[model samples]
Target: MEYIVEKIGMSRTITVPSQAVTLLRVLDAKVCEVNEGIAIVSYNSGKKMNKTIEGQQKKYSLSSEFNRFVTLEVANTEAGDLDLTPLADAEVLKTTFTTKGRGFAGVMKRWNFGGGPASHGHRMGRRTGSIGNAEWPGRVMKGKKMPGHYGNIKNSVKNEIVSFDAENNIIAVSGSVSGANGSLGRVKVAK
Candidate 1:
């Protein structure tokens, strides 16, 4: 089963001796519809509900209108039923989320290209030089590293569960997770 989560922040555990962990809060999700092995779920955000969302909530018999809806493929079990309760018991989970946006970046910072010498004679410093050859293939090859936008892309990371607070609906996982604080995340059992 999959769950919609929010990144709380990163912290270090005192007992673990310098072990860093990222905290994730599981948002309240209600199953709206189920078909075959897929389940449609919805969860509310901080924003207030609107009329259109309210109608969808009423149609699904949900307590309130949710800000977002996600479809999750149910993991097969011996009983041939979708078991969502195992999400809390999972020891390791794979999280998918967007990373922090770095905006526009140069080749030196983005691709770690060695910049030109910083001497007075050098006209170009921290610039991508020799993009293409004079002859032979004449054009810049595809997939060549160039200066452009970086980060703010979907990323998935496997994390080990450090601890879980079921009462508080919080989970602590080792290592850094993607996205900034309060960013939406998707968590599932690591395959």
Candidate 2:
């Protein structure tokens, strides 16, 4: 019984493991649709969702009112066994989502390249150094490390235990999860 939720915000003063805690605000997910052995869940507010979301809203009337999309998959049961009465009833198995994206980054930030000197005619600072030979092959080698875009790609992190607060509906995980605050994320269970 896995699902997804949006990172609403961070709790100002929540204690975590090492030192003090950084509470991550995640709303309870809504069970949208169940098919085969999978379930499509989401969290979104009517205000923030676009027109494309509004059209899909009709299919997920049973879900909560939040402005994000999350898909889920169930184990040991088909879609027929899905219970819609208790919307919040679920178990966390895994979370899948894109990480916090750092777009168009250099080798320094992207690959931890030690930049060159800041003064004295060192112009190639922070740039990827020589990639290939001059005339042996006459071209840059394949799979050479270079500056490029970072993050903003599909990622799946699994086997995270869910820590939820029944009173306030706040959910936390054992380790740090990906994506910036308020980014959409998915949670799913193995079938």
lDDT of 1 by residue, 50-143 (tens): 8887777777767764666668765532322234566667889999999989999999999999999999899789999989978889999999
> Per-residue CA lDDT of candidate 2, range 42-161, in tens?
555335777777677666554336455545554424322233222244444366668878989999998899988989998988888877898888898787778898989877765333
Candidate 1 residue pairs in backbone clash = none
**Top candidate (TM-score):** 1
How well does candidate 1 score on lDDT at residue 119? 96
In model 2, where is the ten-residue run with the lowest total lDDT? Answer: 78-87
**How displaced is residue 152 in candidate 1, in Å?**
1.7
Each model's C-alpha lDDT? 0.81, 0.58
TM values, all candidates: 0.86, 0.67
- How far is 49's C-alpha from truth in model 1 (Å)? 4.6
Task: After superposing candidate 1 on the true structure, give the runs of residues whose Cα lies further than 4 Å from its correct spot.
Answer: 48-52, 74-84
RMSD of each candidate relative to the true structure = 3.5, 5.0
